[model samples]
Target: MIHAHLTEFHGLPVRYVDQEAGLTASQVAWRVQGDSYEEDEGTFADTFEQLLEWDDCDEVRALVVGTWGWAHNDDRADVPVRLLVEAAPRLPALEAIFLGDYVSEESEISWIGQADVTPLLTAYPRLKRLDVRGGDGLGLRPVVHTALETLRFESGGLPAAVVRAIGASSLPALRHLELWLGDEQYQGDSGPDDWAAILAGGGLPALTHLGLQDSVRQDDVAAAVATAPIVARLESLDLSMGVLTDAGAEALLSGQPLTHLKRLNLRHHYLSEEMAANVADGLRGVEVDLSDRQDPEDDWRYIEVSE
Candidate 1:
């Protein structure tokens, strides 16, 4: 009955559905609703519980949980972890979950607070994909899960400790990973060295798609990623929605063989028109995206998603 609130995307395209909507999967947001902006009709947990009470709750495949009417004031706000842990048994077929899908109009990504989510990984062993937004109090402890295939952390200011935890994780089945390293002004503190450690590690043996997007230090990240051994094994790489300059593209040009990858996404960058053309020329066969060029006049760089 509540299967309409779920969707599964393999990458840019949707691939799976739980309900027979007779509609293309691309059009569905699969989001659960909350109350009015001024009224506290229900929290994320309240809506989740309502779904869990349904007879076909186990049919839900991919769920996007977001706040309806309230903005989280702190870490311990909206959608308690315990409720999910308790409902795991009922959602046996659940595979993908995107926690905190609030937009700027609803609540800015930076203001969308979160808490430790390590238990959810353990609670839902069948889960294959997980995307989380916000990083205020978000924590993913070093875990050894086998079935998880995709893991993403989207934040305005991703913490250094969380990066270390991901580096220490034992996800042997992971295939796609993305980390949005936002500006330091919003609390993003992880440096290039931290990312270097993650790239050097052998824990992610099955990773094929990698994304280190939306960073103030895009040039540094690009420099590090160009030389990282992980690049050789990836089929697609995403460095979009950040402040990448010509220098960063130069590092990519000289360091790695971009011709082998299926796709390279470098949209929402600050690269010069000449360098953009060069990138397009260099990777002729590869599907390259160089749109949304931003000009930094006052030495100011903007991350794609922030308050």
Candidate 2:
């Protein structure tokens, strides 16, 4: 498993590979395009080959896979997944991967195409962390892994079936889980009930950090999370970048005993300053983030990433 060293990248904490210390973190990075594909930079396969060529191959731990395409039209989903499959056998020390690093300018989070990621998990038994963006055609059927500790799926409109698959998975060592259930407007079909099932299920016995972020139905989610049995074991809870309002915050403040949490993120909300402060006060010792206050006049609410 990778021991991620915290480093700032584009204002966020990411993991950068450190050969000397055998430490790595996920950082902002982009793979070069294939030479035959109009851009003569480099292909994902080529970059991976370079990584394999290093003398300290056994020391490398983390990788942030990105694309060089300028627009949606230039994105090629097949090559990346194929190259990853080809490279997995040789990446013995690899433990963490952040697939699809494109931002809104390159492609919306929902627009980025993704292949089934189950094979990667099966190939690497030591893998501990996996972060995937874009949910189109994404599937992980009944995965039963041992070393996996953190799993994050950042998508706008995550399908209900995928949510069901996650709830049914057998990852006993998983400690962190985050799912961005976007608006139904973008194909996000998982409703409050789907989330309730995930929370109620005992699939992830080791889970502590939970993030149900970037949803149009955030208030409903917050209301559900307030009473979910999973909250009792969580050390961190993130419900940011959505339509969280005063009512939802009130549910959290009034219902759950958030004193055990180490961190609580409630950024990008529709809460008034008074309400934000009130919620912050409720979780006295917890590190709380209530930034990016939204005005009610902004009639329509949106998730951070949507196609």
Candidate 3:
């Protein structure tokens, strides 16, 4: 049966309305409420343990936990959070876990702040994707080594060190890496060279597609792409929203023979029709895109290459 709680409903009994009906594939949604419950500490611990020990618990495909309200300054909820983390190891068949703000109104405490979700990621092992936004400073560096295929960092400000760390690590199974740098503070200057070096050092060899949105410079973007040894293997290169000019694009496409590059996105730039035509002519097999900028009406004209 599906389970949903409108308040902080941990330690409550699982109400099976029809015991003999049997449980089908179900989803559980919990909402945290700011009400006090009777203190049955020992029973609560036992119940949590029982859930962890259940062998058939692997049938659970998805789990959603929502938190609302704030814990009193003197009242600590670390123990329960630790138990939740420990119980995560029992979910051997879970595919996805989403942690974010679902309610329209903001709560006094962050849901992630109350739960130890990072430990759960390490323990779960089979988790393929994780989406997290707006937490109490959860460190992603610790769990970057997971067998995750798709990882997205949205509304969170990642430091240059963290970005560099991801670039340095080995992620063979990783295919898609999306980093969204929303309005948050960054201290150090992490330019394109650092990103280029990271990609060159084998950070993302298996990555066939990459998207950079907001706060990325054109030269840095070009340098990063040009430096990557695997650029030749990429099927698509998207640099739609950056400071790319004719010079940057020329620098990127000049030396390399991007035979596999099928789609090139150079939108939102000041490239002229003549320059765009030149870039298009250079890549014989690729489709050049210079849309929504200065040169949108240029029909691609190619010159015959001499034998």
Candidate 4:
């Protein structure tokens, strides 16, 4: 099974509008090109036109988008990316954007196609957070942005190349980085070595939160992260939504002292009760989240967000 569609983004409730109306700064706007397979009725271009015409368009601070065309079948719809690139100048207060908000009913996480995202960062200097889903044709160029603070990618099968690119990129101000590396069934094939650059914390001086979630080989991540140099500076770590068993828990507990961290997320795991208890006892003061204990049948452990 997959996760639910986003109800909130960047800490704000999501709102979908169709007409000119007053909008608050506390909510983010959402638009999809088509719903129920309508061709020309609702579209990215049409919605953009409508959005620009709103009385309070300039007051909009955040936006969410998904499925520019034929969402369920189309793997690469580069039109929305181009549309956003062109619309950047008109959105004055836009600070955050979320791409690919569809759930399984619309498109699987791995089915959403993404384009090169370097241009968005270049265009919106004020943009602080960017959350993207789907990695099928996803492309990103190493960028240096001063204002960007949070970058996250959600995928059922994140590509190895994309993972390597993120590790190689230079994000000086990025404080939170999360990547959902699903199983190989979709396109996920990255290993611990692929993200070694990120683990080493080369250009990320402000990073305090790291999430290597939703992977099949979570044990490998745990083993490497336990001894990684980045852990020394991190305030929280998320190894959730993956097939983490007692072996992974043991590696984490034995490798480094996690008592300094403020949070450790190990939800939806296959760890034994004893190992789960050990994790809680090991990090006494930390806000350890060990919820969603799984009961795997025939020793088949599963991840949360893979198709």
Q: How do all models score by TM-score?
A: 0.86, 0.82, 0.59, 0.92
- Comparison by lDDT, 1 against 3, better one: 1
On residues 1-307, what C-alpha lDDT tens digit does candidate 1 reach at each position?
0113224343322322333256433343345545445554665555666666656667666667656445555534335466777888887877877777666666767776777888889999988988888887777788888999999988888887788888888888999999988877777888877787578757899999999988988888899988899888889999998889999999999997878899999999998889999999999999999989999453877878756
Candidate numbers, best lDDT first, in rank order: 4, 1, 2, 3
Please give the lDDT score for candidate 1: 0.76
- Model 2 residue runs over 4 Å out of place are 1-39, 53-58, 68-71, 74-76
Select the stronger candidate by lDDT from 1 and 2: 1
lDDT of candidates 1 onward, in order: 0.76, 0.73, 0.49, 0.81
Q: Which runs in model 4 stand beyond 4 Å of their true positions?
A: 1-4, 24-32
Clash count per candidate: 0, 5, 4, 0
Candidate 4 per-residue lDDT, tens place, 119-163, comes to: 888888888999888877778777778888999988887888878
Q: What local lDDT does model 1 show for residue 227?
A: 87
Distance (Å) between predicted and true CA of 117, model 2?
1.1
lDDT of prediction 3: 0.49
Prediction RMSDs, each to the true structure: 4.7, 5.0, 11.0, 2.2
